[model samples]
Structures are given as structure tokens and as C-alpha cells.
Target chain A: MKKLVIRSLIIVAIALTAAFLTNLLRPEPLAWIAGAPYNIFSDCPETAQHALPLKIGNVERERDFFVDARKAAQFEAGRIPGAFSLPYDSLFPADAAKVDEIREAAGGWRIVVYGDMPGAKLLADDLFSQKAGNVYYLEGGLDAWLAAGYEVEK
Target chain B: MTPKKEKLKTILAAVGVPLRVYIGAVFIAASLFKIYEPYQFALSVATYQMAPLPLINIFALALPWVELVCGVLLIAGFWTRANALLISAMMLMFICVLSVALARGLQMSCGCFASQDAADEIGVHTLLRDFAWLAVSLYVLLFDDGRFGADGLLEKWRKSHA
Candidate 1:
């Protein structure tokens, strides 16, 4: 029993060492272990302030360009009127051309991205990181938008 | 032994070997994705909203390595029972998390494999699949006689030395 336990420990140690070595040798190690400091949602009040509720009155008053960051199918099913479809997953660093297209369309207009809350936030953050100016996200997403009786275009 | 009993044993042992291999292979395959994309896995874990913020990274970093080691050990037939128990525990933990997520109505990805997206919603199907794997792990824990592995050979060598 003791021998078995000892051998198990050794195997576990070896496996972990291999994983550690793999990470160490990688060009871009996993972000968490690489000790990269990330700004949590709470730390960025200025960014959070950019997130707007789906109140129809507020939305109607603003001249912001809304970007639907949901999946293609979801965007097609229904979205805010005049909102352009840009799936969040496709917004990779390699997709600079697509980002440029959105930026061009916005053309100094405030970009309001919305989908699912988490996904919208992520897309907004990605856009901010890429220096997309005046980007905001819709809090609580399309569900909230619908709940607030805002008209959606099919 | 009676012929009927002997036949039953033969059938069980045959089933056990393949099941062991299947479990080990699944673990290895699952671990590989997590190992390669620890950051994504961490994000996935965070989506569950069960673990605290600080511990999510720790779980993400260590879990794939544990899975890999146990998987290899199970395949090698070395410390088969212990490895099976470990696998079973992991399955149980997964089952609990999935169950809680379902009950809480948190629409998130299972995060089992590489790609996690809005479409990868958690449901009863994920729970059922993990439960099936859990049953297999428990079978290995109870019935693995160390046959068809290095453990059998080691035992043989020990007896000869004695």
C-alpha cells in the first residue's frame, strides 16, 4: 500500500513537472500563470460607466451606433434597429480588417455593443484594448432591451 | 468454479479492460485541451461562478496535470485502484458543479473541451454524460484486478524474486 502511494506521488510529480516545462517552453504561456495583471470589472469604473441600461428613452436620445455582438444566427433573428452584426468570436486580433470596417462605419460615433451581458462586456473590453474610441456596452443585453419594450428589427 | 460463474467472470473482465482504456483515453484527451489553453479553461471555470475569483486560476493550472497523471497511470495499470478513485472523485465534483449550475439557471458552457461559446450551454445531457463516466470510473475502482497491465507483471516479478 505504501509502495503504491509512493509510486502514485512520483507519477503525479512527473506529470506536473512536464506540464510546468511545457508552459515554460511555450512562446506565450497561459496568461494566468504568466502573472499578467488583469483589470477586473470592479476596478474600472470609467469603463463600467460606459455600459448603458436598455431604457428606451435613453437609447432613443443617443446617436450611438449599436453593434450586435451575438452569434450570427441570434443577430439575424432580431436585433436593435440600425445595429450592425459583428459576432464576438470573430473579433480576433487577426481580424483587424473587420474591426476596421466597424470603426469606419462608426466614424466618430459612439459604438454601443450588445449581446449577452458577459459576451458584450468582453467584446467592449477587446474593442477598448484595440483603441476603438467611445465604445460602450449594453448592460443586461438584448433580453433587457426587449424587456424594456424597445423595438427590434428582424 | 461453475461453468456459468466462470463465463460471467470472463465477460466482466473483457468488458473491464476496454472500459479502463476508454476512461484513460477520455481523460488524456480532455486534459490536453485544458493543458494547452489554461487561460480559456480558467475563464470557463469562472463562468460557473462556483469557485471564488482567486482559486479559479489554481484549479485551472493544477487540474489538467492531475488528470493527465491519473490517466497515464490508469492506462499503465499501475496503481489502478487509486487512479480510478481519483478519477471518480473528479467526476463527482463535475457532477455537483453541473447540477448546481442547472439548478441556478446559469446558462454557461460545460467547458469540457476546447471551444466554449454561447452555444455550448449546460443542460441535463452534460450531467448524464458525466454520470456515465462516473459509473465507469467506479467500476474500475472496484473491479480492476490489475490484469492486462504492468501491475500484473510487477506482481509476477515480485513472486519470482521471493
Candidate 2:
């Protein structure tokens, strides 16, 4: 029995050593553990670093058109100077040509997108995938702009 | 020791060699891949969701080295019984972890073998595969097959003494 216990202990020790060493050799355990299946692990886009944050001081000149992808009432009350209204739900208007219209209006200039909630980033990624050129986010959206010394019309 | 007892020990030692060699070869292969692509292997380990966030990096660094050492000892035929038993224990632990993860309904990768090749989501299927390896190791304890090993020398000496 004593011998058996000794042997078992030794085995346990070696196994543990192997396990620890294997983990030591492995690099980024958190990412592996997170278990997100969809996001193909890819290098962060180089352009992401260069993309500027949108704000009122430069919202008009910097962006081709500021899209108030928020509720209609919110848009009517106040938005970036010279900004056009396009609520989130109404983006895919039945007309179908609205995509073209938005595209043409946003031609040759960056489109700054803002929304009322968190889905804004996903929408931005999708819009960028759909060939929206030089897209930027307002960092904190209109809320942040409002907090940072900018006035809303309403 | 009694003749029967001596004989049993000889048989146990004799059975251990080839088992160790085969297991060693596998460990070496596993170690090589992990050492070659440490970061990728770490990511796979993390995907398993077993270790805590802070310690994942440390485990990633240590596991490959352990495999290499254990592999080399098995291949060299040094410490045959001890290494065989060690490898067996490791396989048993793997089986347990795989089983628990499967039962929990967590979709993850096994990260047991050389690569997460497809990032093949580990499930009940992976648990069975690891159990198979554990069974092989347990079998080695009974029939070690240590023909070309240091343990074989001990077996020969015991035979002459009897």
C-alpha cells in the first residue's frame, strides 16, 4: 500500500509538471478561453488607428454628411450643423434607391455615423462593408458631443 | 521477495517500455507543434474555458515544456515505470476535464492534441477520444512491453536470480 501510494504521488507530480509546462509554452490563453466563434481572429485594420473621431468643430467640414441614424424626433430637435436625417429603422427604405441616394450624397467625402444606442458600431461595420467610404464614428455619438460644449437645437 | 512476487514485478517492468515509447513519440509531436506555434496553442487552451483569466498566460508558457520533458524521458527509456504512470495520470486528467466540459454544454475546443486544426469545437465527441487514450495508458500499466528499455535489463537480472 505504501509503495502504491508513492507511485501514485510520483505520477501525479509528473502529470502536473507536464500540464504546467504545456500551459507555459502557450501564449494568449484569454482569447482562446473567451469562446467567441464568429469573429475570425484577424489583424486589426491599419486604417482603424488613423480614423479620426467625429465632433461638431469639424463635423461639417470633416464629414461629407453627418447621418443622424437616430429616432426622427431626436433628429428634428438637433444634430450636427448641415446634418441630414436618416433614422436607423428607415435606412433600408422601400425605395431601394435610397442606398444610392445616400451614397451619392456621401460621395467623395467621409460619412460620420451616429445613433441613439450601442448597435451603432455593428451598423457602422456593416455600412463600411457595404462600401461606405471613409466612415467615422462620433466617438460618444451626439450625447458625447452635447456633453462636450455643443448645443442641440431642441 | 517470493518467486511469484518477483515474477510479477519483472512482468510489469517488461510491459512498460514500448508503452512509454509510443506515448513519448506522441508527446514529442504534441510538444513540437505547441512550441512552434505557442501563441496559437495558447488561444486554443483559453477557448477551453478551464483556467482562470490571469493564469492562462502562465499555463500557456509551461505546458509545452512539460510535454517535451516527459516525452524525452519516455523515449530515452529512463525511468520507464515512473514516466508511463505519469503520462497515464495526465491522460486521466484530460478525460475528466473533457467530460465535465461536455456535460456543461459548453462549445469549446479540446486543445488536447497537437493543433486546434479546425478549432474543431470540442464536445462529447472529444471526451470519448481522450478516454480512449486514457484506456491505452491504463493497459500499459498491466502490459508494459518494455523490450528495448532499462526496465528490460532489470527484468533479465530478476529472471537469472529466480
Candidate 3:
């Protein structure tokens, strides 16, 4: 029994070590780890950007670095003027090429995102950690921008 | 030891993999639900009011990651013993939290299934469910039931190679 206990402890220690090393090697294991709690707390409607109202003029004085997190169909219908469209799920850190593309477009500028509200914030956090410049979320999403009478492209 | 005792141990070892898989899948679904809605999970943690704001936020954010990583490991049988132990520890934590809520008569959700349509409310059912899950986890911790796992296959391969 003592031997069995020791062996089990050793195996557990090795496994934890491997997990630590794996996370260390990967740039964004946080994406995988941080997802659980979010799914539990939100109702579907609350997650939508347009569902919640936003703070006014949250994107003033920002450069042309807005990324629309909504789907293509949503983006084509309407979006903040001069904002680039990069749907949320597409921004995984493993996709280095896409990250580079986003980095190049938003060069030396504040990158603001808004989907339906703060739904974009989690995506922005992941992108910012990957070195996207100065990421922000329009306090209220596209609806807020339109509500504030800001310029929007159809 | 008696023959029956030996036989039972063998049976437990044989059935370990399926049991582990069931537990792992549960954690995976639970964790994924929370991950898909992090802010909501954060709010749930805040509602508990046991920990301070900053601590609660960080815990709310990271706990799901632990569950996911460990759950995946458990499923893949990559690190069965470690993941089993980690899950057991997590179950104990949950039991503590659920017990407190029960004692206080706090009507809050257990936050176990983040994507559920129900509000964060707990009662006798939640407590019983958590205890049951905890029992299952404890059983896994005590037994290697690694039957269909990669860990079992690897061990077999190693013996053959040796």
C-alpha cells in the first residue's frame, strides 16, 4: 500500500509538471482555461453586443483600428465607420498569420471592438496579450455607436 | 488477501477507464459552458461574496481553465492519476462552498453548469448532486480504473517493449 501510494504521488507530480511545461510552451493556454466560467454566468441575450446599451462616445479620439467582432453578414449590414471586421472565434492565438494581419492593420493605434457590448472584451483581452496595440471595446457596441450618432458604414 | 478481494481489485482496475471518461466528460462540458461566458462566471463568483473582488475575479477566471486542462487530461488518459487527484481536490472545494451556501440558506446557483438557462440558485438538490459527484471522484482517486485509457495502453506497450 505504501508503495502504491508513493507511485501514485510520483505519477501525479509528473503529470502536473508536463501540464506546466505545456502551458509554458504555448503562448495562450489562458484561452482554453478562461472559458469555463464565462459560459455559466451569461444568458444568451446578455452576451449580444447590441442587446446591452453602451456608454456614449467610447471610441472618440481613436485611430482607424476598430475590429467588428460580429459575423460577416452582421458586418455588411452595418458597422462603425473605418472599423475592420475580424470575427471573434477567428482570433485564436494559434492562428499566428491572422494575428499578424490584425497587428499590421491596427499599427500604432488604439484597437477598439464592439459586438453586441462587452462580448468583445474577452476576445480583445486575448488579442492584446498577443501584442495587438492598445485594444479597447466601444463601451456599448455598434448599437451604441449608432445611438451616439457616430458615422457608420452600411 | 482472499481471492475475492483480489478479483474485485482486478475488476475495479478494468472498469477504471470508462468511469474516468464519464467524469472527464462532465468536467469538459461544465468547463466549456463557463468559458463561453466568463464575465457571467465572474459575476457569479462576486455574488458568492466569500472572496474579495480582485481575488474573486482571478479565481473565477482561472478555475475554469484548471477544470478544462484537467478534464482533457483525464479524458485523454494522459495523466490519469494527476487529473483524478486534481478533480478530487476540486470536488472537495465545491463541497465546502455548497455546504456553506446550504448552511446559510443562500439561494444561489452552484455555477456548475454555466450555460444552463436557470439562474444561479442552489438548494437541497444541488447539495445532494455535488455530494454524489464528490463520491464518484473520490472513488476514482482511490482506484486506477484505467482500462481503456492511453495510460493503460502505454503501460502495456512498455511491458511488451521491456
How many clashing residue pairs appear in each of the predictions shown? 0, 33, 25
Error of 3 at B71 (Å): 1.8
Give the winner by DockQ: 1
Model 2 chain B is weakest, by summed lDDT over 10 consecutive residues, at B107-116
Ranking by TM-score: 1, 3, 2
Off by over 4 Å in 1: A1-11, A31-154, B1-11, B109-119
DockQ (CA atoms), all models = 0.12, 0.07, 0.05
Candidate 3, number of clashes: 25
- At residue B26, give the lDDT of candidate 1: 93
For model 2, state the Cα shift of residue A79 in Å: 46
Regions of candidate 2 where Cα sits further than 4 Å from its true position: A1-154, B1-16, B108-118, B142-148, B154-162
The CA lDDT at A110 in model 1 is 59
Q: Which structure is stronger by TM-score: 1 or 2?
A: 1
Residue A13 lDDT (model 2): 69
Cα error of candidate 1 at position B25, Å:
0.9
User: Which CAPRI tier for candidate 1?
Assistant: incorrect
